[model samples]
Target: MRSRSLFSLLTLVGLAALLLTACGGGGSKKKASSSSSGQAGGTLITVAKGAPSGSPDPQINYTLQEWQILIISHDGLLAFKRTSGTEGTKLVPDLATAIPKPQDGGKTYVFHIRKGIKFSDGKELKPSDVKYTFERLFKIGQSPNAGTWYNVIVGGDACVKTPSTCDLSKGVVADDAAGTVTFHL
Candidate 1:
């Protein structure tokens, strides 16, 4: 009897969810701009994280201010949607074309970056750029301010230790022509 009650409750919940979606829960609803706005591009907002911005190199700065600016200026391999629905909080591909599935018993992740993405310098981004970014992070981010980049990537720690002698490229395989980067754990 308890199992039957549970099943019925679940059925009703599912039906309610379906009804909400059908009623356009996921539909695009245009928002009306406020009449009081002055600028044509809307008001410019300034945010500060209560600290002075430091280090132009992204891998070196760990302060909130640095992160805030970086968040606006940079794109990552993945991103989360800002929506409040089911899509929110889910990891979606950003620079990469899609979320990579782990391979080699969850020890490897291959990312296929979108083609034609350009840097501020107007140069087209390639898979080698991603590899270089990761490598630079591990190499430059040293002791006192070394962020989590070294801890996350597979060969990051070793790369930091030997920076010159070590071949840290083992962790990242970049196929420039194919726009794919494979990270080995």
Candidate 2:
């Protein structure tokens, strides 16, 4: 008799849960259908429980939450392959046409920038901008990974110390005509 009663109670609870779930979609069906059926440009909306900890600048923001959104829009000279397992660790060209062979006993690398790339402002992307960005990275002084990750650059040590006057002429060489940015460690 007790076992039968328990089964009856469980059946009632299961029915109640099913009914509530069926009624859960009050009005979201229409909105979801319109957005998914190509009415909108596949827009993604992200909601965070709290505000970001630091500046929204991609170079400045190192938080994982911000990076989840930033990674979708940003590109680098090389990026890890977006695959599962060990294959994901492989380097793939992004803004760069191809990964160049290291020169100077693996202490120097030259990357050929892809042609016809433009910024949001319609300004042409130049190789010199690549050099400028690294300088800015050290000059900002807020990047936590600057010393650990980029300190191998020739002038990175000096740039980390006195950022305002940081010059990486010897460390980074950008050739506008050749469309290359060379880094010397």
lDDT of each: 0.56, 0.63
The candidate that wins on lDDT is 2
Give Cα distance to truth, residue 30, candidate 1, Å.
Answer: 26
What are the models' TM-scores?
Answer: 0.68, 0.72
In model 1, the worst 10-residue window by lDDT is: 16-25
RMSD of 1: 13.4
At residue 166, candidate 2 shows an lDDT of 82
Off by over 4 Å in 1: 1-43, 84-88, 141-152
- Counting clashing residue pairs in each candidate, in order, gives 0, 0
lDDT of 1 by residue, 118-174 (tens): 665557777787677666655554533323333335676677676654354777788
Candidate topping TM-score? 2
